[model samples]
Target: MLLQRRALLGATAVLAAPSLARAQAPSWAARYPELVFAIIPSENASGVTERYGPFVNYLSRRLGTRVTLRIANDYAAVIEGQRAGNIHIASYGPSSFARALMTGAQITAFAIETNLDGTKGYYSVFYVKADSPYQRVEGLRGKNLGLVDPNSTSGNNVPRFALNKMGINPEQFFGRVVYTGSHENAVIALGQGTVDMAANWWNDEQESNLLRMERKGMVRAADFRIIFKSDQIVNSPVAYLNTLPDELKAAIRTAVLEVHRADEAAFNRIYEGKQGPLEAVDNAAYEPIIELNRFVDNLRRRG
Candidate 1:
C-alpha cells in the first residue's frame, strides 16, 4: 500500500509539471533591492539573532541583493506575514509549510541540510531519558508526552501519524499532553522529567548539534534514546508570496539555489554557527506534507 501511494504521488508530480513550468518562467521586471526572509524563532530571539545575523549579512553581500533576517515572535506572526505578502521567503518546517500553503502561501524551494546525496527528508523522533524505564512509546501509554507544537511538521504531525499507524490514537493515547512551543523546549522538558517523552524533529545536523552540546556538558545524548521515527518528508521549505511576479520569483530562486556552489562561505553562514550550504528544492517536493495535512484534517473533522 505504501509503494502504491508513492506511485500515486509520483503521478501527481508528473501531472503538475506543466503548471510548475509556467511558474518557473522568468518575466521582465526590475529586481527588488531587499529580500526579506522571515525566520521562525526556533530559540529565543536573542540566541537565534546572535547566531544567524552574520549569515544573513553574508547572503546580502553574496547575492548583491540585501538579505534581512526577520524573526517572527511566534508561529502565528510568521503565518500573518505570509498572508500579508510582505515576506519574500522563509524556511518553514514541513508541517508549518503545509498550514501556510493550505491557508494561501506559495512555497518555492526547500532547504537541503542533510549530507545524503539525493534525499531531502527528515525524521520525527520520540525521545526519553536514558535512565527512564520506558523503552518504547507503548510504555508511555498513559503518561504525559511533550509535543513541540500543534503546527510543527515533525513535532506534531509525524508523531500523530506514527501513533495512528500503530493502532493508537494520539488524542487518547497519552494520559496528558502539552505543547513545548519549540523543539529545544521539548528536549529540555524530557531532560528535566517534566514529560515522560518528548516529540521533536531530528535530523543529522540537529543530532550532531545535540552531541556537540553533550560533549560540552550542556546535555548528555546518553541520557536520551529514540523510541520512534516517522516516514521522511521534504525538509522545511523556503516559501514565497503567491502574488510575486514570475520573473522576480525566478531571480530570487536563482540567486539562492545557483549561487551556493560558487560561494561556499556565504552559503554556510546562512546556517548561522552550525552547518554549511543549502541545496535547491521546489514545491513539488512537499507533496507528501500537503497530503498529510489533508488526511489529518479529515481525521480531525470526522472525530
Candidate 2:
C-alpha cells in the first residue's frame, strides 16, 4: 500500500509541473493588451490614417498585438502622450523628439526614415508663391510668414536657426508670424495667399511636401518658389516608450526594421522614403537639433 501511494504522489507532482510553469511564464499580451501608436499631425488626421493604415496593420500582425494609430492634434499632443506613458510608440519630428527628451519623456528612438541613396536626413525650406515678388528671405520682410508648428524642426526650428544665422529675426523681420498648424497647411496657406511666405520641409527629391502636394493636386511645384533651404536635418524618428519590457522593445525594433523587406512600396510611401529601409537610430543622431533648440530658446528669450 505504501509503495502504491508513493507512486501515485510522484505522478501527481509531474502532472502539476507543466501547469505551474505555464502560470509563472511571462505574457506580453497580458501585460500590454494594446499599444497606442501616435503620429505627429504633419497632415490631416484622415490623411494620416489613409497613408499609414496598412503599415499599422502590418505592425499589429508582426507584434501579435493590437496596434492602434492615434493621430495627434498637434506636436505637443504626441509629446505629452509619450510623457504620460499613454503612447507606446510614436513617430516624431526632430525638434519634437528633442523636446520630448529635454522634458523627460521616457522614450528611446529605435528607427529613422532613410532615402534611396541611404541618406537619413532632409532639409528645411522657405517658400513663397512663384509669382510673389519675394525672391529671398530678405524679400519677405514686413510680410506675413507661416510657420508650421513651434515644435516642428523643419517648419520652425531649422527655419529659425537659418534666419537667425542670416541675422534675420522672424518676429521683427516679418510684419506678423502665423502658425499654420501643419506642413501641409503651411503649403496650402502659401498657395492660397493667406501667408506671403511659409517654412516647411523639402527633401529635394520625390520625397518632400512640394512633391506630396503636387501628387495630390493640392499645389503645383511650379506654383511655389523655394527662397531658402537649410542644410540636412535628420529625418523623423520612430520611438518606443522606455517603460516597455525589453523583449517587447526588441521585437518592435525588429519588426520596424524588417517592414521594408516585407512590403517595400508600402514602407516607402508611409515614410516618404525612396525605397530605403528603416535604419536603427539613437539619441546621438539628434544632438544637432538639441543645440538648435537651445539657440532658438535663447533667441526667443532675448526677443
RMSD of each: 10.0, 13.5
The runs of at least 3 residues in candidate 2 whose Cα sits more than 4 Å from the true structure, single-residue gaps closed, are 1-26, 272-275
lDDT of 1 by residue, 92-149 (tens): 7776776776776655554445443445666788988888898778888888899876
Top candidate when judged by lDDT against the true structure: 2
Error of 1 at 68 (Å): 2.3
TM-score of each: 0.79, 0.89
How displaced is residue 94 in candidate 2, in Å? 0.6
List lDDT for all candidates, in order. Answer: 0.65, 0.82
Runs off by more than 4 Å, candidate 1:
1-33, 63-65, 110-116, 204-209, 212-217, 245-247, 258-263, 269-277
> Could you tell me which 10 consecutive residues in candidate 2 have the lowest summed lDDT?
5-14
Clashes of each: 3, 0
Candidate 1 lDDT score relative to the true structure: 0.65
TM-score of 1: 0.79
Candidate number with greatest TM-score: 2
Q: Model 2 Cα displacement at 138 (Å)?
A: 0.7
